[model samples]
Target: MSQPLSVPESHPPPALIVVMGVSGSGKSTVGAGIAKAISRPFIDGDDLHPKSNVEKMSKGHPLTDQDRFPWLAIIRSTAERVCAEQAQSGEVNKGDRPAAVVVCSSLKKIYRDILRGQHPASTKMPPEDDTQERHPSGAHIPATAALKTYFIFLDGTEKVILDRMSARKGHFMKAGMLQSQLATLESPEGEEGVARVDIDATPDEVVAAARKAVKDMIGM
Candidate 1:
C-alpha cells in the first residue's frame, strides 16, 4: 500500500468511499468489509449497472465511455442520497459526516473525476446549493460539498486477477475482459484522496489492510 497522505486535522471524514479496481479485484468483498467496519452501507456497482450494460458484459463485451456515463451518474446520485438520509437521521454528530462504501471499477481518471462531482459533462445532476438543508424525501441532492469522497484502489497483477476470475462462478465479467480494463485504467497514484491497497494477500489480510488504510486516511 502507498504511504498514507497527511490529511488536515480539520478535514471532515469521507462521506463516500469507493472501492475501485478492475474486475475480479475483490472490490465487492473489500468494500463490504470496510463498510461494515465503518458502520455504513455497502453498494455493489454491478448491481447498479443498467440491464443493457449487464447484458453487454455477459456477452463478453467491454463497456464504452458512453455506456458508463449514465451508470456513473446513478452511482454518484446514490452516494449523495445516502449522505442526505444519514444527515437527516440525526444520528451523525456535528462536524462528522455519514459514509457509504461502494464498489466501482472506476478505471479512468475521468471516471473518478465524475464520481467526485468534478466533471459536469459526465452527469447532469446539479451541485448542492445549500448543504444545510435537503429535500424531505431524501432524493438525489448531488451535494458535492456535503459528500467528501475517497477511493480505496485494490491493486494487483492482471495474471493474479484473471486467475481468480477464472475460478469464480456466475459472474458476468469474463477473464478475457481484464485486458481491456487494464488498458482503460489510469493509475490513481498521486491523485488526491486515493489509497492504493495491494491485493496479493489473503482476503482477511487484504480487508484488514484496507480498513487500516481507510482509518488512517480519515483520521479515525
Candidate 2:
C-alpha cells in the first residue's frame, strides 16, 4: 500500500471491481470504460436485478435489504465466475488485471460486503419458497472468496445525479427515488480496496482517477 498510485500501461491480476454508487453516478459508463481499458468483461448490475425488484423501483419504491440480497449475490457470482474462467484458462490478457468489472449500485456497506464474499447479519436469510432461490449462499463465486475485491465509488452531488436520472428514459429506477438512494448509500470511505472518484470531470478523466486509486490500493 505504500507504493505510488500510478502504474505503467500494465495492470495487476484480475480483481473484482464493483463500480458502485447511486443510480446515476455513471457506474455502467465508467465501469465499462475501466473494463475496456483493462481488457476485462463488464457486467452491469442493473441487468442482474430480478423483475420484481425492477418493477418495484420503476414504480418509485426503494428496495428493502431483502430485495437487494439476491441481486448482490448475482453480481458477485458473475464476477467470481469470470475470474475463475480466466484462472483456468491461464490467460493474462490485461497483464494481471482482473477478468471482470461489475457495474452495480452497491449502495450499502452490507451490499458491498456481500459482493466481497461476506454475508452481513442483516442480509442473511433462509431460502425462499421459489425453486430459483437467489440468496448469497445459493450462488457463490468461489474464486472471489480469497481474491482482491475492490469498490470504485462514483461520488457525485445530488443535483448532478438528479439531472442524469431525469434525462434517462425506460430505466427501472426513477428520478423521484434518487433521494432515498442517496440516503441509503454508505460511502466506502474507510473500507480497504475502496476508491472514490468525483463525478465532475469527463468520463476519461474519471476513469483515470479510478485507475490511479485502484493502483494505489492494490499496488498495481
Candidate 3:
C-alpha cells in the first residue's frame, strides 16, 4: 500500500492497542495477556458499550451502528485522553503512544479513524525516539503521526471461536451472537495497519505469535 510505515529501531511503547476481531475471538483474554506481557494498563472495550446495547446483545439481538455510535465515541475519547496524558509527559513525539494498554475492539476502520483523530499532529516524541516526525501524508490530520497504535486481530476457525464463546460466562454478548459477529466481521486484510494471529492455538502460542507479529510489523 504506500510502502508500509517503517517501524523504528525500538517500538514507541504502544499507547493504545486495539485488540480487534469477531465475538468469541478471545479479544479481551488475549488483550489482557498482551498488556501483562508489555506491563501496561488494559482497558476493556466491552465496558464502554452502553447498557442498552448490552441488553440488546444479551437478548440475542445485534446492535445497530446507531447503538454503537456513542460507545465508539467514548472509547475513542478514552484512547485520546490516554494519548494526551502521554504526550504531556513527552513520551510520544512521532506517534500516538499511551501510558497503558487501552483494550478496545475497534471493530471498524472508521472506529480506528475516530480514535486516531483525538490528538493533534504536533506532539512530543516518546522517551526513546527523538527523530519524531509525521509522515507527509498524515500531516494535516489529527491522528496523522502523533498516535502510535497497534491493531492485533485475534483470529481462529469457526469451531474454535464458537467453543470459546460457549465457555464464556456472564458476558453481555451471548454465544448466539457469534453468527452476527461473523456476518459483520471484516477481516484485517493488508489494507488495515494490523497484524493477524490465529486464536485456535494454545494461549502461549498465540501470545508468542502476537509478540513476534508486533516485532515484525514494527521491525523490532
lDDT of each: 0.73, 0.70, 0.58
**Which pairs of residues have clashing backbones in candidate 2?**
12-96, 12-97, 13-96, 14-97, 14-98, 15-98
Q: How much does candidate 2 score in TM-score?
A: 0.74
Candidate 2 lDDT, 90-206, residue by residue in tens: 555546654578888888888888888786656543233221243322243332354468989999998877666666686556555788888888888999888889987776888
The candidate scoring highest on lDDT is 1
| Candidate 1, 1-220: lDDT as tens digits | 1111222234354467999998889998899899888887788766666556677999999877877775676576667766555655644555665777899989998888778876556454323322112332223433355567789999999888876666678765755677888888999989998999998888899999999999888854
Error of 3 at 185 (Å): 0.6
Q: TM-score: which is higher, 1 or 2?
A: 1
How many clashes show up in model 2? Answer: 6
Ranking by TM-score: 1, 2, 3
- Write model 3 residue lDDT over 1-220, tens digit each, in one string: 1122222424354445677888767777777777777655577877655555667899999766656555554455445455454455555555543444556656666556555543323332121111112122211112334455668888777789877666668755555677666766766667445888899887778877876775576543
For the record, the alpha-carbon RMSD of candidate 3 to the native fold, in angstroms, is 10.5
- Residue 47's lDDT within candidate 2 is 70
Worst lDDT run of 10 residues, candidate 3, spans 125-134
Off by over 4 Å in 3: 1-14, 50-62, 86-99, 118-145, 166-176
Error of 3 at 84 (Å): 3.3
RMSD of each: 7.7, 7.4, 10.5
